[model samples]
Target: MKSKKILVWFRNDLRLHDNEMLVEAIAKSDDILPVYIFDPRNFQLTPQYTYRSGVIRAKFLLDSIADLRKSFQRLGGNLLVLTGYPEEILPVLVERYDIAEVYHHREVAHEETKVSADVEDCLWKLRINLRHFIGHTLYNKEDLPFPIKDIPDGFAQFKKKTERDAIVKACFLTPEVIAFVAIEEWGDLPAVEEIVSAEAMIGEVHQELIGGEEEGLKHLNALLEEGSTIYQKSTVKGATGKSGFSSRLSAWLALGCLSPRMVYWLVKDAEETFGTNPHFSQILLGLLWRDYFRFMFKKHGQHFFNDYAMKPERLFSEDREKLLFEEWKNGTTGNEYVDNYMAELNTSGFIPHAARLLLSTYLIYVLKIDWIKGAAYFEEKSIDYAPANNWCNWAIVAGGGKNTGTIKSAFDLDKQFKLLNLVVYKQ
Candidate 1:
């Protein structure tokens, strides 16, 4: 019997604990190589003139991988960092290292699908077993009530369907510990300048946002000890009590440093021990919404990024709105609520969900800007920015061209002022 050499390629799933792909690989192989590629293609803009990822996220992503490398080394495994396409680099690795199998989390978005296909083609040439695991979402797609083609058109319908019936009983898989393979020493992580050209976008935004299993577990324990019980009340308070109840687990979830299942189980445990709290229920609602959006992307394909809705309506028009978008992006929109939200997005690369909704509505309804522009800006800034949510929400707000009821009613600035207790800025 030959000893198996399996390569567990880390993409967004950066952590070790409760990682299904890592667990599967370790069960079959003694010589396991953990690899994370800094795909230059991911950091570059397409010829279509849209950035694949924004500068803040680019920096954060590199930081996450760098952080993961350090942790992997401590655990006796080395993270192999390579530059260029995975198809180009991975096949070379298989030849040099005698890799017998490749394992990674399954991703169903447009770009990832292409990358997956390319990797499959390359691996087929090498005759290695290519394995992909469902490691990202709150619920497994396979366990859903319907096929991706049959997913509900509206989020409300989808959420209800899954919560009521299709929900899978959650399970957490533990990774088997494998002895580290000696790989060559890699240099320091790439700087913002090396990956991107934006000066306003360069900074270590992730120093506080640590990566890896140990750091993730520490943060989870800290939140739980501080009472993960209070998340709902905190989330409603927006920026202030956000940490108290909201879990702030997004960055970790985005990087795959922590599994959504773990978060779900812990909250369930808290509810069992401390009893039902409205706050906890609200937090769970948010998680369910996140899962709903993921399932949405799987069903809709790249239509998720376009301005049309699931009902085949054109929701936003580029020509109908032009100058309004300039003001919105520049934070000179004159609408205080919208500008404030933009400021938060520019500064921290984050916005509370309510803020995002209000501001996006202001763009499409009040100011009449192309929703695609707003979505593009979000793609460039948000660390947690998932395309499905960003584009779908924007389309819904912009009224799907024929102006469906799904579009939120255009907000009255005066009413908003009263709700937010915002002082009127007389322009």
Candidate 2:
């Protein structure tokens, strides 16, 4: 009997450990091809000064793909790299290689879901099955008390209902050996310049973080140690306009380079070994917040893209907004703290969560800028950028996103400035 062939599409879920699609692909097929497609649409840039995926993220992605390819090579598999529309390239691969099935993770964000749908449609035309697994979230949507449509609008309600007797499944043990098909067309990874051009970089160069599962696991392990005081320090700290106080796991978590379940278990184990503190739940809180944003995106499709739907009155004039938006994006708004933080982000594609909230507060509330514009800029530059988290969180902060109906006025800029010892930018 001829061997069955499958293509395992690697998207945000990049790692091998606890990867449902990769595991299932191996189980059901005699031979599997690991594929990562660098879709052209992903490299898109905004008007003139903004990019979709900034250099820091672009560089990180290249490193990740390189690492993934190396891992597949070690396991005697080909991680095919392609540059085109996934829907177009996937069908060609199926027709050429005689692939029996395709396996991928489901992305709930609008654009990501559309891409997946397009690929599915193309695959269906050829009678090829494109199977999807849920890998991004800490908890499966199926296990939630309510369906996605009925998910609670208030995060507290959602968290209370879901975390009550929360049981995360054990990690999937990766197979020691992977059976790969005899293929000679192993594609090489591209350089960062090949994707996003020099012109697309919107700000000063940020430090390039090494990517891949190995680096991600290393980061996770470091945070798991008892002496690591990230939790304690992050709790009381507001936007000191800096990073390094928190788990520093956002980039890896956002990219699916590290599994949320793994982080949860490791931190929980640390609590069991070392004495527990209220601070420990801080990390978990962040993870839960991440999950909530994803769920919110799933429930409220295109609504996330709107501007301050909750408060129509608190808006900047078009001309005024344009000026403020540019200043904020360029990190020249004169809030020295905000500029410093934005400079750090623009330079290296990273900023701490507290700092992010402060900057977002300044941009949305202080400058009266559109939350969507700020979110869009983050989408462009952040190494840890996730659509659901980026936009939805901005909305919530701006008195418009998700379920914050009671918020009417501006955020407490004075309190934030005092906590972080920051001052408004002067002319």
Candidate 3:
């Protein structure tokens, strides 16, 4: 009998732990071929001419891919790194490797789904199956209280019902070993220079967060070690003095270096082992919000990306609008709090959740700039840029989504700064 072979297509879900697709492939296939494609489309510039995947984020992704490759090597397998469109490259790979099927995590955003569709079409022509798994969210979609269309638009409602009705599934255990198809060349991981232009690489790369499952697990453990006391205070001295506290696991979570289920369970265990803190519950709430955004994207389709949904009366001429946007992006807005946050984001590719909410609220309700443009800028720069979370959160801020009335007005910068007790840097 001919040996069965399956190709594991690594996308955002890069880690081995709690990976359903990887575990499934190993179970059903005689040999597995793991591949990560560096799609050129992802590395291009946004319409605003910002790096779609900026130097900091791109480098982090590369580091993640390299780390995953090392993991496969430890398992006596290899990850095939390729630079090209998956639709074109996958069919070729299927033919060469006699791959019986391709497996990957399903994505919800327009561009990502479009790519999946293209790959599915190409693979269909060759009579191959491209299986998709749901591994990104804390709660599995199948186990939700309501169908995707019926999910509550307001997060509080969604959270209330889902927390009552739904249960998070246990994580898939990591396989001890993987039998992989022998290949002549496992392609090289490209540097930031190769991925983006010199001008795109000019910004300060965030050195604090290194991408990889190993590093991500270490970070998770450290956060757990601090217990709920630090988390309860919910303020930390950051690179930018006195920023909001965070687990700082988003970059890993975004890249799939860390599993959402793994994080959820580990946190739950810690709560049980240590004493329960309201902040620990808040951490889980964050994950629930992540799920809500992803499912919202699936239900609403491209509506979140539509700018006309929240289009305001023209406040300035096109040129003036551009100038205002540039000032905001370059941290020259002259609002001390907003500029400080922007500078931190520009330098570190990160800012706390509260900081993001304040900045987005200021951009839309205060600056009177288009919220979609701000979202695009985030897509270009955020190291933790997950499409569903980033775009939908921006839409929510602009009051464009089903949960319009949920986000309170954040236009009063002085009041917010005082409430958070954040000190602004003076020039």
Candidate 4:
């Protein structure tokens, strides 16, 4: 019998622990080649000319890749970093390393799903197997009481059903040791200057906003220990300028550096020891909202790419509206709260819950801009950008989401470029 060589592709999920594909690869193979490809798609601009992933997220992603490499090295393996589409790169790797199988977490969003499918096709030509594990959601789709396509229309209903029927599995434990094969010339992780241009990220970055699984775990610990940050406050308090966010480990979670299960289990463990904190339920509830958005995208594929609701609408082709939309993107809309939020998001890629709602309402209702514009802007700038969460939040605000009710709010001009939710819009 021949020993198997598995190639583990690190996409959004970067951490060593709680990674299903990584665990499966280590268990099934004696030789593993871990690879992280920096896809140009993530760094490119949208149809609106805003970045798909802004400079802030690009920097954070760089940090995460660097940390992931160190993690592999710590486990006696090296991570091969490359720049290109996975469909192009993985085939070359399969040929170079004689890889028998490729392993990765599955992505459900249209664009990501297409990329994975393209890579699968590429690998299939060589008779190599592409194996995927579901790691993105809190509850595994197979475990749902209803099928994924049949997920409830409203988040509250989804929550009720999931709480009654689903279970969040325990986090995967890290392997004590890992097997490796010698592969020379391990690729270098790209620098921030390499991934994004300088002028694209012109504002002062927040000192506290760094990336990687180490930082993610640290942030998660802080959130569990203290309960009054950005994510913990009531949306009313946050919107009315009464409180700021503790932020609930979003950047890390967004990048797959942290696992929701780990967060859940830690909270459960605390309840076991220190008595229950209602804050746990609150934050855990937030995780369920993320689960809902993810499932919704799978339920309704490709509908969010347009203005949503599919009503008769004309393009925002007017030069005046275009100019004003740019201002909204740049945080110069003259509304103090909206400006502050957009400024932070533009500069830091970190927008709090209150800020997200205020900005969403301001952009759609007040500015009379389309919801897709707001969503696209977020898709570009958010460190935590996921198509489902980003678009669904905007859709709800626009009165087109599954069952998210109409948001009522009064709501900007910019430096000429700019970028959803009445609710928390948890990501």
Measured by TM-score, the strongest candidate is 3
User: Candidate 3, residue 171: CA error in Å?
Assistant: 0.7
Clash list (residue pairs), candidate 3: none
Cα lDDT, all candidates: 0.67, 0.78, 0.83, 0.75
Number of the top lDDT candidate? 3
Q: Using lDDT as the measure, name the better of candidate 1 and candidate 2.
A: 2
Ranking by lDDT: 3, 2, 4, 1
Q: Write the per-residue lDDT of candidate 3 for residues 78-158, one digit (tens) a residue.
A: 899999999999999999989999999999998999999999999999999999998999998889989988988778888
TM-score of each candidate?
Answer: 0.83, 0.91, 0.93, 0.89
lDDT of 4: 0.75
lDDT-better candidate, 1 vs 4: 4
Model 3 clash count equals 0
Indicate whether candidate 3 or candidate 4 has the larger lDDT.
Answer: 3
> What's the residue-level lDDT of 238 in candidate 4?
30
Q: Decide which is better by lDDT, 1 or 3.
A: 3
Q: Write the per-residue lDDT of candidate 1 for residues 1-427, one digit (tens) a residue.
A: 7677888888888876667788777878878888887787776665434566766677667767877777776766668876779888888888788888888877767787789789989899888767888878778887788788888766667678888776645555554456655567754667767777574354434334454556677777666665643333223232232333445566667778778888788878877877777656765776776776677677766655444533432334755345556667667777666676676666666666666666765655455455666777777777666656566566656555223433433223344335444443311
TM-score of 3: 0.93
Report the CA-based lDDT of candidate 1 relative to the real structure: 0.67
Q: Model 2, 220: alpha-carbon shift in Å? A: 0.9
Candidates arranged by TM-score, highest first? 3, 2, 4, 1
